[model samples]
Structures are given as C-alpha cells and as structure tokens.
Target: MWKNKHITFFITGGIAVYKVVELIRTFQKAGAEIRVAMTKTAMQFVGKSTFQTISKHPVQTDLFDQTTSAAVAHVELADWTDLAIVAPATANIMSKMANGMADDFVSTTLLALSVPVIVVPAMNVHMWNNAATQRNIQTLRNDNIQVMDPDNGPLAEGYSGKGRFPSNDEIFNYIVEQTEDVDNSKLAKLRGKKVLITAGGTREYIDPVRYISNKSSGKMGYALAKVAQENGAVVTLISANVKLPIPAGIDVIQVETVEELAQAVQTQFVSTDVFIMAAAVSDYRPVHFVDHKIKKSADSANLTLELEETTDILKSLKSRRTKQIVVGFAAETNDLLNNAKKKLDSKGADIIVANDVSQSDIGFGSEDNAVTILQHNATNIKVAKANKQIIAKKVLEVIVKRLS
Candidate 1:
C-alpha cells in the first residue's frame, strides 16, 4: 500500500521520538518517499542531521531559513505531501491541531495540507487520561482526522500505562488496512451512523472470586468497531473482560457479568442505528450468590450448585428497538445453519452470523474467522476464512447493503 506514496513524517516533542527512527526505515523499504519535519523541542531528543541522513533529504525544521532555495517552505512541503503522519505526536501538538493553532513549521504545514493525516499520540498516562486531552482527541476525530490509539506499556516515567508508542508492525499494518482502496463504497454507507457493538465473554459469578466465562478474546468485535469508525460511524463498544488494545475513536463501556452487559445494551440500544451483539454471554448464573469463595470439602464427595437461565439480551430489546438494524452472532458446535436460522427468528434480529466453534483455529480466541450470514429475506452469504478484520469488512458490507 505504501508503494510510491509521498509520505511525510511530522515529529513532535516526546520520549517516543527515538523509536520512529527505525519506523521511517520500514516505510522507505516499502517504497515510500519520506521527508521529515521536526518541532524544535523534538530536536532536543533527536538531531535533524540524523533524519537527513536516513531519509536522504534535508529535514525541514526552520520556518524561515534563508539557506533553503524554496520560495515558501511550509506551503511547498504541504503541497508536495500525499499523506502526512505525526508520529510520537505530543499532547501539545495535538491540542494545537485541534484548535487550529499554527505558530510553527510543523503545525503550519499540517494546516495547509489537503491530504490524509494520521496522528499517533504518546504521552504520560495521566496526561493521556486527562479530560481536556480526551476532548481534544474527540475534536480531532470530529474534524475527520485519523487519530491512532496509543499502546499500553512501560513509559519513560519508569511506570507502565497507556500512551506508549505502538510497535512499528502495528502502525504499518494499520496504515495498510485502513488506507487500502481508501474510498470503498460499502464503507461510505456507514457514514454518520451510530453503531453499538458488544464484545468478549460475560462472566457468571459462582462466588466472590469464582466465575464461569468463555474463551472469546473480542478480536472480531474490536475489528468491527475499528472498521466502523474508519467508515465515519460514531461507535460505542460495550466490552466484557478482554485484554486487547483499544481501537481509536470509539467509546468503550466495560462490563463484567451478564446483568451488567444487559443493562449497558439497554442504555445504548435506543440511540444506535446498528447494533452488533458479538459478546458470548453466559447462559446461566448461580441461583444464590455466595459471599465467599466455596471451599472443597473433605466431608462430602461432591458439591451441588443450583443455576438459573439469564435474560436473553436480544429478545429483551426487540420491543424497545426502533429503526435499528440488529445483528446477532450464533457460535455453535453443531447444526450451525439450523441454530442460526432459529436464532434469526427467535431473537427478531435483522441478521444472524453463524460460525462453528468446533474448529480450534478460526473461532473464539483466534484472530481469524469464517461466518455464514443469514437474513430473513436475503440469500445467505458465506464468507470464506480470513483475518478478523477482513471478516469484519465482509460482515459490514452485508449490513450496509441492508441499510441501503
């Protein structure tokens, strides 16, 4: 996807600046023409000459340097750029971009650009979670700029948290996936739509510390959320217990038990235009709550526990739904199509996506999936096995077509 692309790197003042040095090389290897513009504070961490040596072009740093032959430096650079990436984007630069403040070379050129811009933010965890910073991030998203979600890991402050620079592989893959065929018609249908998605496995507590849960890793739901956001949908993700990097530009609501998940879905379901229920909620819960962890008894050979069925979230929301296209997932070990068809009717869902979880490779915790899409009036669509992101795109294509 980077072949012959005019890509510019805008470096800002951050501890993660040094990490971008090797990242630049990776892009160049993929046939991207790279030029770098650095903030003055960024130069304190990495010198301009280093970038010049690596990119084989003079790094643009000064807003008005008479040494260069160009008539207008920032404007010329902006006109030349096909795509701009702000790596190690500091909180300061992000704030400036959000409010259209351009007092320096980097910010000035960014303001003049007509091409796509990608911002990768890295900062102290406290600053990352600050309300003002978050508001600025939302403003950037509202302005149609793509802001990458920062990774979570060890930081320069000797503690681990969010706001760490993403790995080169993560950034490269994201660029390729999000920018490939940048103007897909299927994706355009999702613009300005409100999508609510559920992910991961809901827990059923047997005691204070013991619970029952599934193996769902939430990869498919996260991929759907990412693609939906890229397609301009305002997305809210209701996530259960899953450890994965949060997708950029999506609101996340965390829940633990089936009851919590049901409540969250009820709160967001009314405002959503599309609701995708991909979470694996436990079928049953303990009849009585045990305040303490149950201990194994030597006096008895076995312990018996009572259980009761949990509320079916999709069925409960059927009456409350208005103009919402509901999608549900049926993960089955046997009779996939029959079970999925039954679910489509019983749950009153507009679509049912079924996949066999008996195969260890393509379902649950895996990164890839193949699904059979079933709808009431439309013909069934079978998507071949592929990465979760690819599967997400196919699933969304079907949804968007139904919307049209």
Candidate 2:
C-alpha cells in the first residue's frame, strides 16, 4: 500500500525506540522510500548506523552537518517527505514540537514539514498522564497533528499501564487509512455502528492443568476487529486465550471458557449493530468438576467421565435480537455448504462463514484462509485462499452490502 511513497520517520529517545526498526522494515518492504531523522537523545537509545543500514539512506541527525550539499538539510528533507511519522515520541520531544522548539534535527525537520505529521507517543505511565504532557498532546491535536494513543501493557520500567508503544500492525493500518486513495464512503461504511467480535478457541477444562480446546489461533477474529475499526465502527472484541496482540482502538474482553464467553457476548449484544461469533467454542464440557487431580487406579484400566452440552450462544440470542445482524462461523470437515446453510437458519444468523477445516493448509492456526459466506436470500460468496487480512476486508465488504 505504500508503493513508491516517500515516508519520513522521526525517532525520539525512549525505550520503545527499538520497536521503530520493525516499523521501518515494514514500510521498506511495502516499497516506500524511507528517510530517518533522529534526535540526539534518540541516538543514545539506537545508533544512527542502524537506521542508515535499514532505510538505505543517510541518517539525518544534525542541522549543521556539512556532509550534504543541500542549502538547508531540514527544509530539503521536509520537501522530500510525503508523510512524516514521529514514533516513540518522547514526552520531551512532544513538548518541544508542541512549543515549536527546533533545537535538534528531528524537531527542525518536523517544523519545516508540509505533509501531514503522525505522532505516536511513548513514555512512562506517569509522564504520559501528567497534566503538562496532556496539555501538550492536546495542543498538538488541536494543531491538526495526528496523535495516536499509546497502548496499555508492560513498560520497560517493570510496570504495566497505558504507556507502551502500539503494535506495528496497528500503526501500519493507520498509515494505510491516511495514505490510501480508497473511496471515502466505502471506508466509512460502518460509521456510527457498533461491532462485537468473538475470537479464539474457548477452553473446556478437564482439570486445572488440562483443558480441551480447538486449534483456532484467533487470527481471523483479530483481522475482523482491525478491518471493522478501519471502517469507522466502534468495535469490542471478546477474545479467548490467544497469543495475538490486541488491535489498538478496540475494547477487548478476555475470556477462557465457553460460559464466560457467552456471558461476555450477552452483555455487549444489545448495543451491537453487528455481531460476529468467530470463536471456536467447545461443544461439550466435563459435567463434574474435580477439585483435585485424578490419579491412576490400580484396578481400573480406563476412566470414564460424563460430559454435558454447552450452550449454543448464537442460537440462544436468536429470539432476543432486535435490529442486530448476527454472523456465525462453521468450521466443517464435510458438507460445508449444506451445514453452513443449516447453521445460517438454526443460529438465526444473517450470515454464516463456512470453511473446510480438513484442509491442512488454510484453516485453524493458518495465516491464510478461504471461506464461503452464506446469507439468507443471497448467493454464497466464495473467497479464494488468501491472507486473513484480505479475507477480512472481503467479509466486511459483504456486510456493508447487506447493511446497505
């Protein structure tokens, strides 16, 4: 999406500065011409040579460097840039930029920029929440600079809070939204709508140490959440125990068991305009809960435990739903279309996305997926094998058509 674009990266000193390397590599892989400008403090955390090697361009670090023949280095760079990104934007640098201070190369070049500037703040939790920093951030926002909120997680200070840097995927999606020439109306198709998505596989515990769960890795669900957020929907994600990072700007509820997932969905279902049940919930669970671990018996060769059916969460919400459009997923080994159509009716879902899980390549923990989307009174749309991100856009496109 960044094909042939000239992108300028302004790095400021922070522990999170290390993450900017991956972001730079991603932009470079997307065919962007990247130039990096780093503050003196930023160089303390990451060497200028690292940026030079990755971006394949000379790192800009000084306003008085005689290395280049350009009349004014900062202005020349500012003119060359199509978009400027200030990642790991420290509190100090943010204050400088807010007050129009240009003591360093990063600030000087930013001050001379004509293109839109995106500022991603990274700082200690207390520093981020400080009154002065908040004021400066507000000032930057008021000046039409795009300031993305830092994520909440463990920081370098051995503490956890809302001061961590956002994931590369989150930043990449934001850049795509800003730079892509996609149809504005299509981009905002879900404007003012609420989307609730459930992802990952729910675990049914046999004991404290062991549980039965599917191989769902939550990639599809996360993709849907991202695509929905980019389409202007207020998104809430009910995620199971998956190792994936949460997409920025979405409310996430973590759950382990099917019962917990069901309750979480019920709480959000009323206000949701669109609900996608992408979670791979266990169909049955152990009927008896053993407080202690079961030991091997000397006489018995095998042990038997009763199992009970789990609640059909989607079907249970069928009669209670109002204007909401519900979607369900069917991971079938056979009769994929017929079973998906059956599920479409039985679950009272507006759409049923069916994929053959028997395939070793495309389903269950795979980065790519192919699915047949079945809807009432509409022909099934079969999406070919592709990355989950692409499939997500296709799914949202169909939903937009249905909602229209």
Candidate 3:
C-alpha cells in the first residue's frame, strides 16, 4: 500500500534492531525512500553500515556532527518525510521521547517533527514493567504518539511474557497508514452491518452516595465503535457510567446499572448484526439500595449489603439472536485460558477475548490490551499488549471474517 513515500525510520537500542533492516528493505521494495537515524546504543547491536548499505543513504547518528547537519539534517529530515517511525524502541528511548528529552539525535528529531510518529517498543519483560518505563509510554500515547505493541514470544533473555517486537510486516502496515498516501478498499467489510458496542463499567448502587464499579475507561469500547462507523457500519454504542468522551458519527445509549444495560442489549439485539459486549457489567448488585449512605458506628462491628446476581445478558438472549454474531470478554486473574473457554461456551459467544490482569500489563483501565481471541472450538489468536485502537481493529477483523 506504500508507494512513492518518504519515511523517516528511527532505529533505537534493542535486540530487535536487526529487524529494522528488513523493515527498511520492505518499505523500499514497496516503492518508498527512507532516512535512517540510530541511537548510540543501537550501534552496539547492529553496524551503522548495515542500514547505510540498504537505504543507499548515509545514516544520521549525531546531534551535533556538523558533517551530517551541514545539510540541516534534523530539520531537513523532519520536514521532508510524511511520518517518522521508531522501531525497536528501547526502555531508555521510550523514556526520552515521553519526557521530551532531546539528549539524543533520534529523540530530538522526534520531538521536533509534528506530522505523526509511531513508536514500536521492544525491550526485556522486566524493563517493560519498570515504573519509569510505563510512565514514559503513557506519556507518549497522551502526546498522540501511536505505539505498536511488541508481540509476546521468546525473548533474547530466553524468557517469554510480552516483550518481543512485532514482525516486520506488522510494522509496515502502520507505516503505510501514516506515511503512504493511499486508501485500500478492504476497509469496507462492515458496509451494511448493524453493529452495537457496550462500553465502560456499569455501576450498581449500594446507596444514594455510594456504588460499585470497575476501572473501565471506555477507551477500547469507544474505539471499537469508532472503527465500526469508519467502516460504514450503522453503529450504536451502549455507554455506561464513565466520563469518556464518545466519538462522533454513531448513536449512543447511556446506561448505568445491569438492568439498563440488559434492557438496552435486548432492545438492540434483533437488528444488530454484530453484538460486542465490551462493557464491564457488574456481576452482582445490592439486594436493596439504601437511600442514604451507611453511617459508621462503633457498636456495629460489621455491615453487610445483601447481593443478588445480575442478569446473564449474553446467555439469556441467545434464542433472541437472529443471524447475529455475539462476542464477550473474560478478564481474569488466574486460570486464564480455562476460565475464558468456559465463558465462551456458557455465554454462547462467537469469540471470547481473554486477558490476564494479575501481571498488570493490561486489563481493566489500561490503554493496552493483551488478549487471546478464542473462537470455534478453541482456534486462538494471541494479540499483544498494544493500543486499544489497534486491538479494536483486530477484533473487528475477526467479526468481519466470521460474518463473511
């Protein structure tokens, strides 16, 4: 999809730096020119000559080297390209970009560039979780920088959780979107589908002043709704109790409790071609809501609010389904795969997005989602921890494939 585009490719220090050579070649073969910039530490893993030879352009690695900047390097490079992409972004580089630190040439160019930037993070599992590293990543996203998630696989450390970089093709897809000036017709899979998505966490009131809810930011669900609308689907978003700003170009049904969500889902189910239950619905609610918040008294050692099971919205509506695809999510702390499989069958979901939350990499309120899409007798797709927009796009692909 990328043709006649100029891409500013930034290479950072990581074991995955070798992959960038292939990434550069792929873009070149697709009819594009590339400018290469490498971090000081990146040179330790791969030779500067490797990228220079493939790009047929001398690499830029210095911030103050007049020999390179004699051409007004950073400004020229930043202004000449459509977008900049940093592959194998190390924890060190992530921190630099997040905090607006321009100590290095690559990061300095990144801060100066205004078009668009995509950061492909690659680092050790431990480093990915370090408090300092996470803060930086969040900062980058908030700054409107798109980050491609590193796939979970065997790391150079011989350990595996979620710290491997995505394949070259995956990175190329993103580059094409940001840099290339072309549109593909494959985005019309949802042309006539009536899609409904529920987002955020529903609240069950314990009292007039208190309630029970989960930490769902509504980002994933909102993104799903947005993508559906972009693909020509008539989308309806059943939003719950969150302060999230819903995207334009879709209908929104606001709900607060399980009763409201269940009612909304049932009302929309018959006409909906794809039902995405993305809301974190409360499993239980107070048997009786107190009009006033409970008071603390020394004489009362304990206070218990009776609980009642909420409606099984998914299972209850299976008979109401009419050529519609149903999807659900299982956010778990332990026994992830097994629990997800059970929910998939019992809830009658076409696909169950199962995610592990105990590790804290993703789940609940995180912007990134690491999920295993279990479908059709356990055919699974293990998606990495990346931006929710990317995850939503992939999820929609599954729905589209199933529908077709």
Q: Which structure among the candidates has the greatest TM-score?
A: 3
Give lDDT tens digits, candidate 1, residues 168-259.
99998877776886752446779999999999999998898998789999988998998788778999999999899988789999999999
Candidate 2 structure quality by residue, lDDT tens digits, 74-184: 766775676899998999988998999988788888998767789998988999999999999999999988899999999899989988999999998887776576432
TM-score for each candidate, following the candidate numbering: 0.57, 0.57, 0.58
Per-residue lDDT tens digits for candidate 3, residues 1-404, read 44545678899988888888888898789887887999888999998999888988778898776434223567556654555788888888888888788887898888877667888999888888888988888888898888877888999988797889998888778666654563332345788789999998989999888998888878778988987887689999999986877688889999999899999998999998899998888999999998887899799989988999999888998778779999998878999999999998899889988888675557677766777899976569976556676578778877888876
Off by over 4 Å in 3: 1-187
List the pairs of residues colliding in candidate 2.
Answer: none
Candidates' C-alpha lDDT: 0.89, 0.87, 0.82
| Shift of residue 169 alpha carbon in model 3, Å | 26
- Pairs clashing in candidate 1? none
Give residue 173's lDDT in candidate 2 (0 to 100). Answer: 88
Ranking by lDDT: 1, 2, 3
User: Would you give me the overall lDDT of model 3?
Assistant: 0.82
Q: lDDT winner among the candidates? A: 1
**Clashing residue pairs in candidate 3 (N, C-alpha, C atoms within 3 angstroms):** none
